[model samples]
Target: MIRFENVSVTYEGADEQHQPTLREVDLTVPEGELVLLVGPSGVGKSTLLGAVSGLVPHFTGGTLTGRVTVDGRDTRTHPPRELADLVGTVGQDPSAHFVTDTVEDELAYGMESLGLAPGVMRRRVEETLDLLGLAELRDRPIATLSGGQRQRVAIGSVLTPHPKVLVLDEPTSALDPSAAEDVLAVLQRLVHDLGTTVLLAEHRLERVVQYADQVLLLPDGVMGSPAEIMTVSAVHPPVVALGRLAGWDPLPLSVRDARRRAGGLKARLEGRVPAGPDLSARPASGKQDPGPGPGHGKGLDGGDRVGRSDGTGRSGGFNPFRRRRTEAPAPAAAPLALVDALGVRRGRVEALRRIDLTVTPGETIALMGRNGAGKSTLLSTLVGMIAPTSGTVRVAGRTPHTTTPRELIRQVGLVPQEPRDLLYADTVAAECAAADADAGAEPGTCRALVSELLPGVADGIHPRDLSEGQRLALALAVVLTGRPPLLLLDEPTRGLDYAAKARLVAHLRVLAADGHAIVLATHDVELAAELAHRVVIIADGEVVADGPTAEVVVSSPAFSPQVAKILAPQPWLTVEQVEEAL
Candidate 1:
């Protein structure tokens, strides 16, 4: 019911600056169908949503050279209020969109806005509360909710209208595995049960690919030519990374489909299903021993990953000259470390209870939990962003609370769930420089760190204009400017494509080999398997399970994947590992 015809947008920049962000773009969405807006960051995915919501010219002060019609009305003619009934939108940042202080009132505000009767509003509010599993938090203040809970309220506020179309931009980027599942389940039901047309704008392809009926490859920059961005196309489902690597034509949209296809293909290729990676034995060095060589990095910079295991070393090493080999990782020791008691609180609600844990260095730690499980709160408290309400958190020998953020910067760097909070600079160079400065190092040294973290940041572009992956890279660049020994990434892979995710994993490996500890909080099981050395399942502010990644992921039936691996989901983390087993 929404259409973009030769639409182009030009926005005024700093001090009367004018530039086009989207070219003459053409797009169409049928009713009761699902479409995915897919591309890298800053590709105008948000701008496309703005066009449908009538916020482009009114709020952005832009020139519109084409037509955007929603529900048959020209977007140019209808104000946002007029179109509010037909379409609902959720921005990428859930915190930025909350309209009220409490979850209950937040849900009711939009209903009241539309002049619904109080009785009708009450019924809808109750229904939405149950639908999103927010009934427990209905009366809770919005400020007290976790990132995932806040996002649920955002979705509920919009769904109350029962609009014909729903638009969500990276709804799960900030959530843990359990909480992300909760929000995604609600969206799935909206399409299958309510027949609400869904248009999701996201870069995290693995999460939504399974359900999308259509895939639109939006353009990368501003211009009205429709030359590159917003290239809409039909897509058949397959697992995102698998399809990309196997070069499957008509990439699959779901993990189930990908599993079946992978099984059949592997059976056809090597006459058997791919066995899981052999974790029983100490993994061979997949690459050369760490020392100065052609591939070795200067100082702490990681050496090029051997592109492929040539019976001597591992693949995916930092080798800019050679093509990257599509392979999986070899199994190694699970990362572990010691912890005494850890606890944190937000206002009156306890974010984390008395907790104890230990993970080794050079391991990927997957912290899985439901919304409000206190995963992020724990991470923040650990990294000194917020002090612990009680107990202690440690990296090596120092407690973060006992040390300043500056001190932690050299030992523990935190990549926030929402990366934009750290990106306020006018330019990429300035932001990276600021990050370098915050790390208490010289600007030149920080610049070198930025090049290593982001790999391809130019000097003149606005940091805001960079891609989602680039923005994360920039934030990480700032976080790691001091070469911290412990890095806590709160969903670093959220909203990233397979390529971007792979790159992030590669970066983590680079840092880990140099002895940095990595703890990632995410809802993505697939990502955890591929990257994490261990898995920790958190429920109700306590770590319910902690073990090797394989042991924990498979033990929890609900969190385990149905993907047909040579082994179950947990034991075999990457495609290369599976292939090696086979």
Candidate 2:
């Protein structure tokens, strides 16, 4: 249903230069198959997706050689609108695709644009709402919906058009585990039942690897069976990594398959126990303990001593599962930040309720909940972007709301859900230079950090032209340049592959060890498993559960990572932990 013949994409660059994003690629996506396109950051995955929907050269102002066809219609001859009936494209940012205010209306907007009959539009809208499990949210305004909900609405909107080919970029990147499964299930039904062609790109492979019919390896643009491609691919999910470590001949794609082959591996790991204190056994005390020291080599200085709740100062450690010592020693320093009785109202909606939170130095906290559970709202409030309707937020002993931008940049830096929002300069180099100048850091500091986070990204490329993962890396570099005492990142792993995520986790650990408090609003349970010292669960704008990572994630079904789920009854959280035990 989709074909790319001898295609090459080149974008305009400095000095009238042209940079090739895709080089001499030939591909064919059979009808009714779910094809997963994956590669390293900035390796032309999104560019390839854009070509299928005719956005590459036409809309993006790039030069496209050869041809791309969807459902036998040449994309070059037909613009996006002309192919709208046959092709529906949902991008990484769902908000950019929205044209209507309400969920029901958003679902109907595409059909309306296609000039469908009102009755047909109504039936399709209802069917889509049921198909994607958006029935309860049909009447809700799109602005009030959570990130995951907005993603569902975006997919449902395009689905209403009944396009033969659906093109999606990171469709489930924002969804919680259950929500991601729901979205993937809907895509599978479209492929199996209706024979619709679904092409998608996602970084969180653990969630979607099992559902793929075939894998399209980019850069080289090689296509093969999922198992075959996964064996050689670097950007694979945790399960694939685990399979590799265990020496499974054919790597298992799904958790079920992994479990079937895990018997022997499990036997090998039978008597092994994860290193660290037993989180459940550790009693809650007034004073918190300072756990393991830093692991990230170089650049980060881990010499700062954190005062324990008991008033004893100790060097930082890098244990991922360390519990936060709640009760500091009587003479200990105050928390780096505090949120007391925080309430925020956005118009008629209560975004955040009376929430109380504390962040001590050197603590890595994961703020997790269903999408729209006040996670982003809380982050915004902490950074002074959103003024709370009531309650007080203090970071570095100063009110975040009343602090100046210059001071706030040094005290607390926030990376919002859309990383592009933080990028403003023309090129990556310019952005990095600007970040250094703004943060009063030495020249090349931001660029060096970007190289550490996302290597191989050209300095001259426009920030807008970089892949989602690369943009996030640049944004993160920009934020870290200030060396803020507190860091707030919302859904930071949206487009990062496994390797990128690993780098981020390591850097975060180093940051935590260096006495910087980190709070992340994310749907990535696996990240929480690997990096968070404390897991804070929010629901309906209230803190439902707050405890050490193990206590919180292992107790909840929706929040547990794959390793935790596989090795249930055991306190393991990652492949590295499993490896360490054996």
Report the number of the highest-TM-score candidate.
2
- By summed lDDT, the worst window of 10 consecutive residues in model 2 runs over 304-313
Give me the overall lDDT of model 2: 0.79
Q: Write the per-residue lDDT of candidate 1 for residues 1-582, one digit (tens) a residue.
A: 888898988755511334566887877777887777776555577778878888777675668889999889898999888889888988766777887888899999987888999999999999999887788888788767766777778988998878888988887676544556667788788888888888787665555655666667756322221112222222111244345556655555555556656755464445343342222222333321211101112233221100000000011112112111112344243323345677665656666776776544554577876666767776776665666666766666677666765455565666777677777888877876676566556766555655655455566667665655667766766666666666777777765655555556666666665656678887766667665666677666776776555556666654554332423433444555444444
> What C-alpha lDDT, on a 0 to 100 scale, does residue 474 get in candidate 2?
84
| RMSD per model, one decimal | 9.8, 6.8
- Stretches of candidate 1 off by over 4 Å are 11-20, 177-182, 192-195, 220-251, 259-338, 345-348, 440-470, 561-571, 579-582
Candidate 1's TM-score = 0.79
Best by lDDT: 2
Q: What is the C-alpha lDDT of each candidate?
A: 0.63, 0.79
Candidate 1, residue 479: CA error in Å?
A: 0.8
